[model samples]
Target: MSMFRHLLGVVITLLFVLLTCAVILPILMLALLKVGLPFARWQALCNRWLDWLASLWMDANARHQQLLLPTQLEIEGLDNLSKQEWYMMVANHQSWVDILLLLRIFNGRIPYLKFFLKQSLIWVPLLGLAWWALEFPFMRRHTKEQIARDPSLQGKDIEQTRKACEKFRYNPVTIINFLEGTRFTTAKYVQQKSIYRHLLMPKAGGLAFTLAAMNGQLHRLLDVTIHYPEGIPTYWDYACGRVKTIQVHIRQVPIPAELIGDYTEDAEFRAGFQLWVNQLWQRKDDLIESMKSTGAN
Candidate 1:
């Protein structure tokens, strides 16, 4: 039965992706063609199309999940959010299914979620182009070693990020940052010797850059923590209806006036910002423990 459900999910997922590309690809092309135009109206029109297409895709896949799985979700703290506000959202990463879970939970409740894709993902076929059309920010983060080799590369990525954020100035957007930077696993937890029992170390740089780029426009910072009562499930497990319960706890964080300074150049602000992020992580880790204890009962 599980195998049959998995196969059904795989087929439906593939068909949805293919159908999305077929419909959105042309809009993407047209958006590109009109990119250089002086007026912003055409670009806005294209963006609306992309947002509509993305919402449709999520709605369809959500229906598929309902038909193929008996998953249960418990979501809290969604009462105060609006789809019309610009937001910067941070979440703990766990598995590939996390993305799908986010889409399912936040569909229509907030502005369409847009991820900051790894720069290399720009090469991915179809979906990559779709992301580009939808104006998802693609970021290439440079390491200290890479920066030492080419001093000229310093702050280049930040500039690109700023330009990308400029595109969203006219639109309401919910930008999601996986602050852990990667998925959590037992191996990873032990390797990092992380203080948090359930979470990897939160990376502050990405969130910092996003806040710096969006600045005053992104007033609300959503600190989202997700947990599975049974255990973290793989994408296949989720597709096969093995994941029965999901808990999503959202905390709306107000961007402190002091924390919104220049993250790239300011030293004092950097220290303060990192401390704030760590504090948030500690709280989230504690929250997960509390949730687990309650679930055990």
Candidate 2:
């Protein structure tokens, strides 16, 4: 009976998501075109609507399942944030549910969170249009093998960075990147013998390129650490209300002047940047341990 109820819940939630995407997205796109609005303006409006719709959807689901987020989610250093400032947010990856937690935590406090996604994802059905309307940066990454075959591909990554970040100059934006590149698995942790307790290897190149492109325009870094009380929860667990409480610790780190220069062409700077990222990850690992111990107590 529990399994049957779970299946029914899954079916209903999926149908709700699909129906909302199908019905609302097309109308939003056509409305933008009919009004002869520029893409960015349309995107901003679309994102506002999407956010509202998403919150409504999630709230309904949570209520149905009798699930509640912690009433007093401790957020340190949020008072340091300025409404007029631009920010770069970096966090450790776990599951798709991270997005929900982020939105719930920082929804009105910061400017809308935008992710650096792949260019191919821009055409991904309903979700694609919504993302496009939100003005997410669609990046193109060049693999080492590809760049090795054609050296010219080296600079192409920077060019993609410039194009993707072009709209930020006019808007106060918060760009979020998961430095680990992927979620942590126990098998991966064992294979890599990762330095951090709850994270994978940090990829420095992406962070280097983003900082170089944004330069002084980005003011602050929101370093977030998220932990699940009962092991690492999957997206299914999140939707099914298995995740009862989530602890999010936010720290504000300044963008140092030393890191503002071009990192791709400078070998020394790249190495330095990697070291800086490693230090940050080490601190995050310690924080995760502290949170887990506290929760256990």
Candidate 3:
């Protein structure tokens, strides 16, 4: 049975990659055409088509997951969402399966979610190129030491954020930032001396910068909390239908006017922002504990 499940997982993984490559070919061509045509209306038309193709790809994957994985997904508070409204999705990071989960749940209910990717990811074969064409923001943060050596590197990420936000103004889009920065693991949990039992230290700067960058255009926040009752599962576990249940809770937070400020320059705003984030994470930690207690059945 275990061997059969493993083979099923392999087949699922291969089919997913094949689907991604198939979708990306037209994306590449449209991207080239958009580049060649400098007219704004023409570009906008191309953008719409790109979005349509991306939607088809996500829809395909959602069907694929539903057909193969028997994971019981229970969701809450996904109500009155519109593709015409802009949003910021802040979620905990746990596993690669989370991406698929998000894609499946939010596929048509909202506009496509744009992610902030590491700059190096643009070179990742097919999917990377699609991300580039679709205007996913790629960024790299410079360490203090690196900044000290190359003074010009300062504020590079901020500039990139501003540019990306400006483009997003033309279309209503949902931007996602995994505020924990990376996947959570026991080793990472201990390494950071994390105060939260189920999460890493929440990085408030990314959220703050995004709020600031949008200049109040993005006013609604989707506070997404994903819980796996049977421990966090890997992509393989999900693909093999080993994940029996999943829970997602979302809080539609209103972005207060006070939350938008220069996170890098304003000392008071930075302190306040961090406190807000800490309080939020604290609540999420408590919520996860409650979920564990109730979901263990």
Candidate 4:
């Protein structure tokens, strides 16, 4: 049975690659067309096309997963979502599976989910250009030492990332940031001496910087919490159709006026924002514990 599952995992992986390969060319083509056209209307048209292709890609994968796996999703708070509005989603990260789960669950329900990529990723040959064409915001991060050495470097990365964000102002988009920054692990949880029993420390600076950079254009916040009831599963376990259940909770909060400010320039705003984020994280940690205990989820 183990060998059979492993074989199925390989087959499932191959199918995923094939599906991606099928769409990549069209994606690349539209991306090039978008770049060549300087007109705003034309670029908007291209973006719409790209989003359609991505949504279709996601739907296709979902169909196959349902056919191949018995994974059951228990979800709450998705009814109010729409694709027409701009949103910022903050989620707790666990494994690579989180990305797939997010894309699958929210496909077509919101504007295509966008991720902030490392600035250096733009150099990758084809995928990078495609991501750029799709307008995935690339973030340039400078370490404290580097910033200390060059006082001028402070806030430069955010300025660049904000300019990249400016294009989304023309159309609605959902930007997702995993506050934990990295996937959660028991080791990491212990290392950080995490205040929450089930989560690593959630970083407020990224969300603050993103909000400030967007200049409050993001209209709502989608607070998403994902929990694996059977324990953290590997991608292979999910692909092999071994994982049984997933739970998701999304609480949509309005982007309050107070939450938008220069997180870099204003010390007071920074402190308030950090407190707000920490409180939010604490709630999520408590909720995850409830989910674990209640089993009704």
Which residue pairs does candidate 3 place in steric collision?
none
Off by over 4 Å in 1: 36-38
A best-first ranking of the candidates according to their lDDT comes to 3, 4, 1, 2
TM-score for each predicted model, relative to the true structure: 0.93, 0.82, 0.97, 0.94
Question: What's model 2's overall lDDT?
Answer: 0.74
Ten residues in sequence with the least summed lDDT for candidate 1: 22-31
Give per-residue CA lDDT, model 2, range 1-297, as digits (tens): 568547755864675476556555655665466347657777666555655554454455444434432223455656766656789999988887787677666766776678888889888867677666556778778889999999989788788877777767666778899998777788878888887777898988788788878768887889999888777777766655556677788899889888777687788888889899999999999999898888889
Per-residue lDDT tens digits of candidate 1, residues 121-187? Answer: 9888777787877778898888899999999999988888888888877789999999988899999
How close to the true structure is residue 56 of candidate 3, measured as C-alpha lDDT?
A: 93
lDDT of each: 0.84, 0.74, 0.91, 0.88
Superposed on all Cα atoms, model 1 deviates from the true structure by an RMSD in Å of 1.8
Cα-based RMSD of candidate 4: 1.9
- Residue-level lDDT tens digits of model 4 in 1-297: 899898889988887888888888999889888888878889889889998888898899888887887899999998988889999999999998999899999998998889988888899765586677678888878899999999999888778767877877777889899999889999999999999988999888888878877887898999999999999999999998889999999999999989988788899999999999999999999999999998754
The best candidate in terms of lDDT: 3
lDDT-wise, the better of 1 and 2 is 1
* The candidate that achieves the highest TM-score relative to the unseen native structure: 3
